[model samples]
Target: MRLEDLLPSPEPVRFVAADGTETPAPAGHVRPSDELLVEAHRRMVLGRRFDTQATALTKQGRLAVYPSSRGQEACQIAAVLALRDDDWLFPTYRDSVALVARGLDPAEVLTLLRGDWHCGYDPAAVKVAPQCTPLATQTIHAVGLAEALRRKGEDGVVLALIGDGGTSEGDFHEALNFAAVRRAPVVFFIQNNGYAISVPLAQQTAAPALAYKGVGYGVVSEQVDGNDLLAVLSVLTTAVQHARSGRGPYLVEAHTYRMEAHTNADDATRYRDEAEVTRWAAADPLARLQTYLRHRGLIDDEAVRTAEDEAEAFAAEVRTKLNADVVADPRTLFDHVFAEPTAQLVEQRAQLVAELDAGEA
Candidate 1:
């Protein structure tokens, strides 16, 4: 077959316009119910608020650093909501909102960002892998876990989240190749937020779209307007269903922009123009989704206020917990590393305890 015949179409699948108008979903797309739509809206609102609060915490030194998902809430929330309880989520550091949406505690989800030793929550209990810091590494773990489930005859799917920058990682290619060859039940959701820190997409890859990379691996690939909540939800839900039904892996490249700097430590002004940021801000996922919900009479001023109130409560709770003193036990460093501590680890732990005791004396 010709290369053209093997590629996914260039057009992204979208069900909502930038102006918040309803567009027809592609044929066979199942429209979400009013309840699901409302719930999604609530989560989006809460996600944005959570991001705002977390960013503030970074400024106040409550958090070591934060990669704000300010403009990417729709993609994060929709990805998690599309998964089943038994499904696994492998997230990057920027995916705290996704974890929270998956029913993990917000404060616990931020534990890593809070400069804690280990991931705050138990991954096994929540079916979420630790928020991976090394780019694209989690993709390999995700494919391996999915393949293991398939081998064991377990009905579980894995959703692996990566950024535009991660697409350039070698692990990303390896994971896609393995998933395609093994027919692993996994979905690779790439949030193309236009930058990997100061580097822009044009400099990242010359591929027509990141989804095209998946096509080369013989994986079903598609793109969506990541800022549109309904569009993201629809596309991700379809991909999740496909994976769960014993179909091979799918790749979704969500076209979105990061409205904030890469993290608390970087200056976005150095890399991007203010007008460009303004253009994306106009297409803000939260604003567009609110407009759609209000236009359809699915939400009202009262509902908006209620959502805002709930978001504030969530922010307040996170703030209170984060501000409280957390006593760190130095011994915890040796825990969970091995079934039994090595002799070297035992000696190191004893030396650390002795140093602490000496300092106290």
Candidate 2:
């Protein structure tokens, strides 16, 4: 496709309106199946509740910090639901919800944020990178993995998730250029939630949208209504396929909002007012999706209850595990530092063990 043809639509694609009604579809945009929508609704309900519980945990001091993906649940869940089990997921720190949706243990997902361990779960086992906190760095890692998969003739693609703020990072650009040139089977999913912590999009870049950046890098790109789950899933499903089909890389910019402060430590009131928050909340992803599902007779009270029950159970387990004391071996710090221990490292490890032995004696 021509670069211009690959450029995202001037307006974001949407299938569900903010008011719980269906909207007219644009050319090339198709409604996701009812089966998919129903499944998404269930997971989204679980995801939103999980997000709330995580935020509560931070307040209760169980976690060192938490970046809640409250309003961005649509983006968070769709990014995962769009992918196959074999596909790899690269998530940002704010993507614990996505990690959970991908069937990761919630407590394990928060391990890095809790300052307990480097990675609580095995990335290779699940094909999920640790939830990244260093901005667009995951994008580069995803590209490298995608290239490796290509070289190995594996039928896999990588979905590298980032935020609008991450687009400004040099790593994000480098990854895009490399992926485009190498035709790496990777998709860069950017949830443009209107802020890079305190800085607004206006101060960040003059580009029409983040997806446009991909076009310049020779990657197919599109923008979707991030607040609309159907729209996000539709756009992302197509993007993933495009890359899987050897079309190089695809970038999707989802226009969404951050309903909470950057982290538990941030005071959002300092930068944005209540009116702005209220305005965005009016377009809440969960509410809109639920509305559409109910209107279509896809979900009823029983299904709602089922999702709530599951979410509560999920939250309870996370609370129980995280609140309990953890026992970790100090030797693990030395174990993975190198495949073959350097002489200095071995000596340091011996010294540490000796010190522990002396204390016991």
Candidate 3:
């Protein structure tokens, strides 16, 4: 089939609706186990709560700044769940939910956004690299990591997440090309949220579909409804299996929407309209999942209240810990600069200390 035929259109895979409706799974993809569905629901709820509380903290001066993933929960959770423990994760700034679901602690994850170190947890410890904010640079790292693991005869893959905006960067193509040549065990997960900040996909690329970009480099590819949790999960599961089983890298373009401001610093209201926000809100991921759960008798009003209470407490605790933790000294930045400090680095450090002592603003 021609790649253009798979690009997103008005009608894509949709499961739960804000008002509660179910969509059937695509052919060749079996219905997931009940346990997996429940877990997906829990993770999405937690992720949404975490993002909302973090944003609130940033607004109240408790946190530095926040980049929200309001309407992209299905895309995030589906991909993360598809990975094995040994597999690696390459995340972007908006992938906090995925990171947490992959087991990153919320308190530790916040340290990065708070202008501290990368993340308190070691990337190697959890197989998740620090959130890369420099566009598609992490795509290169993902390719490299996957290639290394493959060369060593390791049985694992790398799952790299990027926004549609990232496709415009040279690094994205370069990484894809390198992964293709090496047959790296990796999957490039692209969440097409319409806008790369304010730049829409139409302005970013003329390619028939982002997934088609894989065709140029012999990468296997697929397109899934980013808003449909079931579709996202099924597609990612197959993609991961393909990579792990040595079929080469896979590209999954999830067509989704970004319902909130790009970041706390952004004014989405400037580029988009209120009607759009209302429309997307009505198609929220959590609402549909809850509706499904309720319909299946898996959750009820009491369970909903209990989940909200737990999420609220968790958010409150995260704020308290963030405020209470000892802020790292500014001088410690120099400690990790080298194995042994260079003479020039030593001199620079002394100069900085002297300036601090002199109270030179």
Q: Which one wins on TM-score? A: 2
**Cα RMSDs, all models:** 1.8, 1.1, 3.3
Overall lDDT per candidate, in order of appearance: 0.91, 0.91, 0.83
Clashes of 1: 0
The full ranking of all candidates by TM-score, starting with the best, is 2, 1, 3
* Model 2 spans > 4 angstroms off: none
> Candidate 1, which segments miss by more than 4 Å at Cα?
1-6, 351-361
Error of 3 at 356 (Å): 9.0
Candidate 1: C-alpha lDDT: 0.91
Cα displacement (Å) at residue 143, model 1 = 0.5
Ranking of candidates on lDDT, top first: 2, 1, 3
TM-score of 3: 0.90
Task: Say which prediction, candidate 1 or candidate 3, comes out ahead on lDDT.
Answer: 1
Clashes of each: 0, 0, 0
What is candidate 2's local distance difference test score? Answer: 0.91
